[model samples]
Target: MQKIGILGGGQLGRMLLQAAANYPVETYVLENDEQAPAAHLCHHFTKGDIKDYDAVYNFGRRLDALTIEIENVNVDALEALEKEGITVIPRPAVLRTIRNKALQKNYYTTHQIPTSEYILTHNIQELSEQTHFFPAVHKIAEGGYDGRGVQIIETEKDLSKGFDTLSVLEKMVNVEKEIALMIAISQTGEIAIYPPVQMVFDKALNLLDFQLCPAELPERTYWKAEAIALATVKNFNSPGIFAVELFVTPDGDVLVNETAPRVHNSGHHTIEAHYSSQFDMVWRILLNYPLGSTEAIMPSVMLNILGSEGHSGPACYEGLNEMLKIENAFFHLYGKKQTKPGRKMGHVTVISQERADLLYKANKIKHGLSVITKADGRSG
Candidate 1:
């Protein structure tokens, strides 16, 4: 049996492990937490820091192929493993470029990809001097995820909120809507693109609240967005799944917002809505199998369950029974014992033939479901 290892055994890895069970493969996962979601599911689980050079290097050496659930893993070790004939999805080079906001923006500009203009700043002092570019989005060059390490600097006064580190000051675009495309590429170069997913953000937390697959976009805008996503993965030319997030302006212009070179939150609905889930697609990529169909059987909406504010420690799910009462509702809880404010704990997906009904149930689930925890240490 072939051996595969994944870095960071979080929810993404957990889902991937579940998918791998359908095939004859031995799976391993390296994570710092013993209680990580994938730990119990994988054939072999090692407790280690994914970012530690020695830990990643040692783990990659024993695998027939290696992949990542998170982007913050040590890329140098992956690069070394690639040189030794072990396959690393997304390619170490791609991760190095995608992990840094400044470098990623530059790649888009170099390829003539439509994206918001950005200025790279070395420090907060330099960022303050760029006040002329006020009302920009300040993003840390690295380690930003789930709306963290990002700030909207509306004025010079907001510069104080930025980190004193390498970052990018991106000119905020006038966005009509936000959407994402899940593109899967095979080892032999075949590609499959899922229909665009419309992202709806929570204004209060600046995090993704829910998503609608097959975003009700005009024909022209939809095709344009697809073109951008295709061009992006082609540019990297690596065999793996990529999620291209985009912004559509009121004038129908499509611009690339960012890309995640792995299974993503926007594609979660695919598990029940599409013929091939993102988890299954990744397995096909790593094993060089023919890519699966990306067709959706029905319209779907996905709601993210974030930890409620002002509650921390052990995690609890409230009103799950009520949320599950909705027709065609599917719940997936990440095996996290503890919860923190704004942390992603789980998600709910709903599907239906009627778009309106699907969206209504999505909102209902969002309101009815809550991830809360008490100060006491135990979780139910």
Candidate 2:
């Protein structure tokens, strides 16, 4: 059995481990927590910081192929492993591009791909002349994720809060809506893409609040999302799944926002709604196995279960049975012991053959449920 080494032991890594169990493959997960969800399932477990060079290199050297559940891990060690003839799918070079937003945007420009105009600023002096209007997005080039390290500057007074470190000043295009699509690529040139999904965010932190699969976009928008996502995958030449986030403008313009070269939170709905989930596809890609069908069996909606505000320490879900009263509601909880405000703990997906009615029911479930505290017990 060919062993695959997965970096980062969060829920994504955990699900990947479960999917690999169906095939004749062994896995070694490198993570910091012995209680991480993937730990008990894998063939071997190594508890170490994924960003440390010697730790990551030693882990990659033992596996037949290397893949990651998160992009925050050390790329330099993966590069070293590649030089030593280890098979690191999606290549370490591609990781470098995806890991940094500036390089990622540059990849689009270099390939003649259409993207919003952006200006890079290394220091306070370089950004003396600001062509951008009042409302714009300032994104940190490195180490940002899940609505963090991003700010929407609406006034000159808002600029001070964003002037800390290396950043990219971008035009805050008037976005009509937001959408995302997930695509998987294999070594034999086989490609498959999940139907584009619509994303809704919480107003507070711009955190992903919920997702609806097979977004009810006009035929053209859906096609455009697919086209953009496919182009991104081919450009990366990656051997794994990618979630391509897109922005739909008020004038019906579709622009690429960001890309992730691994299993993504946006596609979590696929577990209940699609013929094959993204975790299963990641395993197939690493094995060089024939790609799976990406068809959705039904229209689905996903609810993100974030930690309650102003609570930490041991966490619990209070209204699970109440939430499951609705038919077709499936819940999956990440085994995180501590609850921090706005932390993503788990998600639930609702699926049905009928699209429109399911949308209504999904929204009801989303509103009626609370991933918050127990009325009687301690906070979270």
Candidate 3:
């Protein structure tokens, strides 16, 4: 059997493990937490730090291929394993570039890829001195994910709101809408780009609340976004799935926001909406097989289930059954043991050929679902 190892056993790893069950492969996962989402699902689970050189290196030594569900692992170990003939998806160098926002932005500039203008700051003191960058977004150079490590500085007063380390100050362009393009590149160099997903963010949480597939956009805007996404994958030149988020300005300009080199939240709807899901596509890429079709079988909408406010402890889904009452609505809970305000507990996807009906069902699902918990015999 082919042996595969994955780094960081979070929800992404959990879903990948679920998909890998269809194939004859022995899977192992290395995660610091024994209770991680994928810890019990894999054939072998190593409760160790994915960032430790020895832990990651030793884990890859016994596997035919190594891939990461999270990008914060030790790249040095991956490089060593790759040199010893073990396949490392997306390559270690690419990880090194993507893990740091400054380097990622520089790569875009060097490659002539269109992106928002940004300035790198080494410390909070330096960031405070750059007043011209007001009404900007601040992102830590490394270790940022989900809605963490990012801040909006609207004025001088907001300068005290960000990290005091290496960060990027980006001019917040006037955006008409945000969209994501999920692209897959196979090991043999074959590529497929999915239909654009229009996104709407939760202003309070700074996270994607829900998204619509086959984004309702003008033909020109659609084609330009597709071209930019394809160009990004070509520039990365790595095998695996990529989620490229873009900003569409009111003037019809599409600018690169950032890119993720793994299965992303934006593509979650694909599991129920597309001919081939991102999980299946990633597996194909790892095995160097020809990619599956990227066409959407029907229009779909995905909504995130976040932990309820004022509740933190053992988790529970409050209205899942009610939410499931909607036809074609699918729910996938990330096996998280606890719930805290704003934590990603799970997601629901609704699909239908009729755009209006699809959106109507998606809205019902969102309102019906709630992730709440009881702690110390109290709701909070």
Candidate 4:
């Protein structure tokens, strides 16, 4: 069996390992926590920091191929591994560009990809000088993910909220709708694109609240999104699955928002709704197998299960029984033992033929299920 190692051991890694069961591959995970979500699922688990050059280098040298659950890993080590002939999915160069917000934006501009205009700043003083760029979004160049490391600078007064480190100040688009397209590319230059999905974020938390697959879009807008997403991934020129988040402006123009170079939350509903899940697609790419179908078996809505406010301790699920009784609902808990406010604990996917049914069930689950701490004796 071919051996593969994954960096980081969060829920993404856990789900990836779950999908690895069907393939003739031995899996390994390197993480700092011994009880990480993916630790027990893999054949081998090494407790080490994914950002440490030596730890990542040593762990990957023994594997036939390597991939990542998160982008904040040691890229230098991945570059070294690629030199040693161990396959690194998506290529280290791609990660280097995507991991930094400034570099990612510059790449978009350089490649002529449709994206919001942005200005790079090295520090707060540099940002203050660009007051005319107010009402923009300030994103730290590196180390930002899942709603963190981003702030909205509505005016000069809000500039203090901007990062003191290198960052990107992007002109916010007049967004009409947010969409995500998942694509998978193979080593031979073949590509497969999943239907674009409509995403709705929890504005307060800046995290994805729920998303509907096969997003309803005007024909022209849908085609535009598809073409732009394909171009973005094609330029990466690497073999791996990618999630391209985009914005649909009021004028019906589609612009690139960001891209994730691995299995993403936006495509999580694929586990039960599509012929080939994102997790399965990643495995196929890693193994050099023919790309699987991205066709949906049914229309679906995925709701994120987040920790309740004022809860922090051992995790507890309230109203889970009620949710379990609902038809066409699939629940996936990440096996995380602790609960903190706004933490992503699990997700529920509801699939149905009718859009009305999908929306009704999704709303019910959104308000019904709650992740809270057993110590608090309260549910959100």
Candidate No. with top lDDT:
4
What's the candidate order when arranged by decreasing lDDT? 4, 1, 3, 2
Q: Considering summed lDDT, which 10 consecutive residues are worst modelled in model 1?
A: 371-380
Q: Which stretches in model 3 have alpha-carbon errors above 4 Å?
A: 375-380
lDDT of 4: 0.93
lDDT score, candidate 1, position 245: 96
Q: What is the lDDT of residue 249 in candidate 2?
A: 88
Cα TM-score of candidate 3: 0.97
lDDT by residue for model 3 (353-374), tens: 8888877887787777788875
Candidate 2 residue lDDT tens string, 1-380? 99889998888988888789889998988999998766777888999999999899999998889999888889999999989988887788888998888899899888766577787876544544563544677888899988887887776667665756677877887777789889888987789988899888887978887788778788887787788778877988767788988888877788888889999999898887898999999888999889988999888888788887876656767666677788788888887776678888888898987776667776776677555655455533
Report lDDT (CA) for all predictions. 0.91, 0.82, 0.89, 0.93
* Per-candidate TM-score against the hidden true structure: 0.98, 0.94, 0.97, 0.98
Per-prediction backbone clash count:
0, 0, 0, 0
**Range of the 10 consecutive residues with the lowest summed lDDT in candidate 4:** 371-380
TM-score of 4: 0.98
* Deviating ranges (above 4 Å) for candidate 4: 376-380
Question: For residue 40, what is the lDDT in candidate 1?
Answer: 95
In the range 99-193, model 1's lDDT, one tens digit per residue, is: 99888999899898999989998899999899888889999999999889999999988988887999999988999999999999998899899
Name the TM-score of candidate 2.
Answer: 0.94
Write the residue-wise lDDT of candidate 4 on 1-380 in tens digits. 99999999999999999999989999999999988899999999999999999999999999999999999999999999999999999799999999999889988888999999899999999999998877899999999988899999999999889999999999878999999999999887779999999998888899988899989999999999999999999999899999999999999999999999999999999999999999999999999899999999999999999998998888889999999999899999988888899999999999999999989999999899888877554433
